[model samples]
Target: MSLLLETLTTGDRITFICTGLLGLGVLALLSRPKVVAAEDGVTVTNLTTTRRLDWAQIVRVNLRSGDAWVHLDLSDGTSLPAMGIQPGIARDRAIADARALRALVEAHGTGHSAT
Candidate 1:
């Protein structure tokens, strides 16, 4: 009877541990950042990083080969690449965005950093 009780308790412990692990995994997934682009700006959120940028701060947009790259032009002619970029297949929309980005960069004096 004692051995049976011990076996049951061990099984219970294992179940408890597994349940806790599963719950933690779900929590992690739920905490992942959400990235969104708005009419005025871009927002990026994640477990470890959160960034937001306004339209005026954008330097340039480049669609190279199959990848879309964003260049943030700075006063010193350096640029920073913002997150939330998708790789490959940037055809029409990417080109349009790139043109808009170029216009913005030209307005800002043409110094930018590339990612």
Candidate 2:
């Protein structure tokens, strides 16, 4: 009887350990950084807080191959990777969003080629 009890206790301990690890992994994913482009500028946020950037400071915008990126280039030659935009995963929306961003960049007079 004691041997059976020991086995049950061990199993419970293992289950509890696995559950804890899974919970931590979920938290990490939810806490990932996300970026958004608004009317005034762009905003970068994460589980902790948010950041904002004005449109005038933007240099260029890049559309990458993956399904989870929408980067914005700054005037200082720095690139800011954005989130909440996964066009590659959804072809229709991705192409539309890319076109809109390209138009906005060109309108702002950055003079960058869209190749």
Candidate 3:
């Protein structure tokens, strides 16, 4: 490995470093945050935290215009951001996903207490 590193020209080394940095940037953006829906609940995993909420604890799912992603309104008077449904290049797809999530919340989150 040391021999290989020593054989590269300055330009080649710069190119290699730039490519590696660009790859890392793409990876970081792709790994930002996400949400997952299971049989009984949804999980929101962000860069720093992962939160799981049962269906009964969710009051509604909101994806208003101009918003970056879906938001979950909980019965506990707090809201959680669903980063999986982000808006940007795929706005229509994101809207569709938000609708599907709303349907899931409505189907399974009604008539139950947050206890």
Specify the highest-TM-score model's number.
3
lDDT of each: 0.54, 0.66, 0.81
Q: Which of the two candidates, 1 or 2, achieves a greater TM-score against the reference?
A: 2
Question: Which portions of model 2 miss their true places by more than 4 Å?
Answer: 1-21, 24-35, 46-50, 66-68, 108-115
Per-residue C-alpha lDDT of model 3 across residues 23-99, encoded as one tens digit per residue? 99878876878888999999988766789999988887887888887788888899888787887748988888877
At residue 93, what lDDT does model 3 achieve?
89
- What 10-residue stretch in candidate 2 is worst by lDDT? 106-115
Worst 10 residues of 3 by lDDT: 106-115
Task: Report how far residue 102 has shifted in candidate 2, in Å.
Answer: 2.9
User: Candidate 1 — which pairs collide?
Assistant: 33-45, 33-46, 73-112, 78-112, 78-113, 79-112, 79-113
Model 1 misplaced regions, further than 4 Å? 1-31, 61-115
Error of 1 at 73 (Å): 6.8
lDDT per residue (tens digit) for residues 2-102 in model 1: 88667777679789899999999988865664445566665555556676756555555544564544444544455554333434334565556556555
The TM-scores, one per candidate, come to 0.38, 0.58, 0.71
Worst 10 residues of 1 by lDDT: 81-90
True-structure lDDT of candidate 2: 0.66
- Backbone clashes under 3 angstroms, per model: 7, 0, 0
- Give lDDT tens digits, candidate 2, residues 1-106: 8886677777797898999999998888666765556676667665555667776776766775653666667777886665544575676776666666667667
Error of 3 at 106 (Å): 0.8
